[model samples]
Target: MLIPLIALAGVLPAPALARGMDEPRASLMVGALLAFAAVLAALALLVQARRLRRRDMQLHARNAHLAAANAELREVTERAEAKARMLDGVLAAMADGILVVDAGLRLAGWNPRFPDYAGVPRRALRIGMPLREVIRLQAEAGEFGMVDPEAETERRMAMFHNGTAPQRLQRERPDGSRLELRRTPLPGGGYVTLYTPILAPAAAAAGDAMQAAFRQEWTSRIPRLTAAAADGDVAEARAVAHALRGVAANAGWTRAAAAMEGIEETAAAGALTQLRLLTAGLPQDPAAWN
Candidate 1:
């Protein structure tokens, strides 16, 4: 409306000059100039308003995207926490001690049995602590005997760092309990150590007694048993071989048990040649029984 009024004023000024109205023409000219300035200012304000609206829309979009990303991050965190809790519960219920270290050789996780098997206090084995430190503490507690704790710790740490293969060994704790230790490496450059108590004093003593009785039985019986097999006495050979099988199996002599089973089978089948062949070298391989 103001633009059209200014155009009408421009046309009217020429007519006013033709009508010789000089004073009125001058006032009309000033009014037309003000209207034109107002129109320019109005256009500027409209352009600014459109730009503000567009910026507000962009801000809303960005905010929505941020909120979605935050929600996803929170969900992932919750899932990880749930899995961790499940793992913790499973480890706690296990009978053996489990200790896991990270790529940095720092303690990552453990079960309650760790402290018991390691002979170290629970407070001494903190998560994220260096495994060397834990070993030092156990050594100080006399788990490793009278050796220098620092040197022993360094030796153990070197095994992992130097790309050692998985190893299993049995060592005695100062508390009279024997533990079987197994160290396994992770594909991602870390290690896990498991400690399983192998025997109590009573169990070890009983085992020793059983082994002594088995050794005596083998010593007294094998010569006669072999002689009977060599003589083609199938009944006597089978009976003696069966008896030795039971004793060997009970005493954890896997190789000897297998040999005894072969002997029993040959005797039962009356294969005199195979029986004699098996008995021919029995005395020479006595270490197999031991």
Candidate 2:
């Protein structure tokens, strides 16, 4: 609409100029002026339209890049959050008591196992409560180690700051449960204390049974074979030592099994005196047989 109006205004000026010229010349000059003006207007409009179109293309490209970057950022954030949730689940499910303390020796975070092992209610745990104070209270109540509380607290603090030594200690609960305590530093100016319960008597008994079986079938055979060698029964001694070697190897006692192998080799070589010497210091108690 505006282009046509501008073209009409240009032609109107040409007619006013034509009044001063002869008829044919006036008509020709008017036509030339009208054509020139129309060409100039069209060129101006073309340049303006090209500039607008280029601006629109640039805007669309910038928006697409921003949308892609935003999607990537959202994906990264979601993955990080998922990992954090997984870590939280793992910590919650752990049997060991875990407590995180800040640089000021104040409790920052803890697992449910903390109160369970400490024999205290969960309400006793709170942020900003001094770690030394908690340790002292628990120790006094026989929840922690037998060491002097003040000295132990100082040692832990020293270990935390130095990073050269491990902050490990032992504690016995009132229920006769033993605990192994260790403290590690967190990345952002804090520390974590982990309390792992020592194996109970029932579990220890089961382990002892397995150990006893191994010893009976292997270690106990050594002395008997040596006695047979002393009695001048080289054949019996060699047979017994060879049997002990197989038993020890099967029980995963590699070093002991190797020793038995060496003894068998010596017996095979008729070195009974060496075998007697090796077994001389072996325990004699019946309980030691196990």
lDDT tens digits by residue: candidate 1, 1-290:
46545655555556546567677767877677767767876886788899999999999999999999999999899968965774565567555799898999999988899999987889877779998888888888889888888898888778768877347998888977788989888899778898977867797798679778878887677887889977889899999988887666666565676688788878988999989999776853435665
Question: In order, what is each prediction's RMSD in angstroms?
Answer: 21.4, 19.6
Per-residue lDDT tens digits of candidate 2, residues 1-290? 36755766755645556666788976776677677777877888999999999999999999999999999999899968965764565566565789898977698888888888766668877889887667666666656456676777677557656765467888677788788889887788777888888888898788678768866765567668768878867678778877876665555454555565666767777877886776566553323433
* Model 1 stretches astray by more than 4 angstroms: 1-42, 145-166, 199-290
Local distance difference test, candidate 1 = 0.79
Error of 2 at 72 (Å): 1.1
| Lowest summed lDDT window (length 10), candidate 2 | 281-290
